[model samples]
Target: MTTTSGFLLDQVMVTRGETRLLDTITAHLPGGHCTAVVGPSGAGKSTLLRLLNRLDDPSSGRILLDGIPITELDVLDLRRRVGLVAQQPVLLTDRVAEDLRVGRSELGDHGIRELLQRVGLPVEFVQRRTSELSGGEAQRVCLARALAVEPEVLLLDEPTSALDGVSSGVIVEAARDHVAAGGTVVLVSHDLAVVRGIADTVLVLDHGHLIAHGHPDEIDYLEAGR
Candidate 1:
């Protein structure tokens, strides 16, 4: 693993033309904690999360993992340690089992089944076609795929949006379980209730700037809006 410590952004900024997508963001997401980034659309929550795993680079400043600049690490190795589950789940192969083996080509059926079980999927799901899965089922499959690599950190964007209670609950528990097992999770969401349940620290953003960050109970999320 490239890092055991969580992410740190130092005076980071992202600019396009005259606009700043993220401005001077500075935060420490410690290992073994769930940190939620929340705000209305265009708040730069996703922008900031994307920077952690090198999906996008900052115009200025740095991002570090385990006290080393992310730019200094091999991008592929970094991604393996810090897995990302995007807003939409995309299966690489038609079958669910093959999709989980993207970063882990040598993973056997036993390992694949364990990953599915970790995400609350049935063993039978291994042979199912991704196209036949429901929204919730697909998301679970994505989660299992991300977990297949045994990532130290998970970056989730809008993880539980528009899902049934059972699926949402499973996703929530997965984040919690990851933290419980000494891993870190950085989650971006519009749902305050979900954030309240999982976030050990909450970051409120507005128009590319970090407005507030602290424990869930300390932040005034009402003013921030979804």
Candidate 2:
């Protein structure tokens, strides 16, 4: 399949003051497909997601979004198109409704309700304070907020890491629905089961290097040690 809106990383490298975070990574993230980035801790899976969304620039090489260098695109516009839901949900205000409204004033009450339902939340929760939400609920709210923006690419960084099995399943369904609607999803996860359930393609990272990229079955052996 041709990916007109896919991401291309060419010799991408990220370095901190003294350490290399990611090294010479090259890969293609096809559009309309769910690509999972998996590896042990400190393997730069999250770092790769940040680079894809331009949260930070690479130390060397280029990242292309739909064949256009990301540096050439407007920062705010790029972020809007590529929404990220971090491991921890960061709410802008106390009210769940207010948090969803951030960066998306165009969303009406009906829109907010739909988004909440899409992430398996009840419409009544919109008026509830963030303080009242459990860890899983908060994460789902964050996912709803990200979807509110209608992003072309959704980057999920271990979205269900802190949640229970049922909560994790809800998040997985939300992501699958997004991809089914022609959205591209890049998932950073350590849960092999979750990756196997949703990933169409998998990218394995180790010590900031791209170790492998193939179908889920091709990398299933990575689960042996865990």
For every candidate in turn, the CA RMSD to the true structure comes to: 2.4, 1.3
Report residue 204 deviation for candidate 1 (angstroms).
0.5
Write one digit per residue (lDDT tens) for candidate 1, span 53-112.
899999999999989999999999999999998888777799998999988899999999
TM per candidate comes to 0.94, 0.96
Could you tell me the TM-score of candidate 2? 0.96
Candidate 1 ranges beyond 4 A from true positions: 1-4, 222-226
Model 1 C-alpha lDDT versus the unseen true structure: 0.88
The CA lDDT at 214 in model 2 is: 88
Question: Which consecutive 10 residues in model 1 have the weakest lDDT in total?
Answer: 1-10
Cα-based lDDT for every prediction: 0.88, 0.90
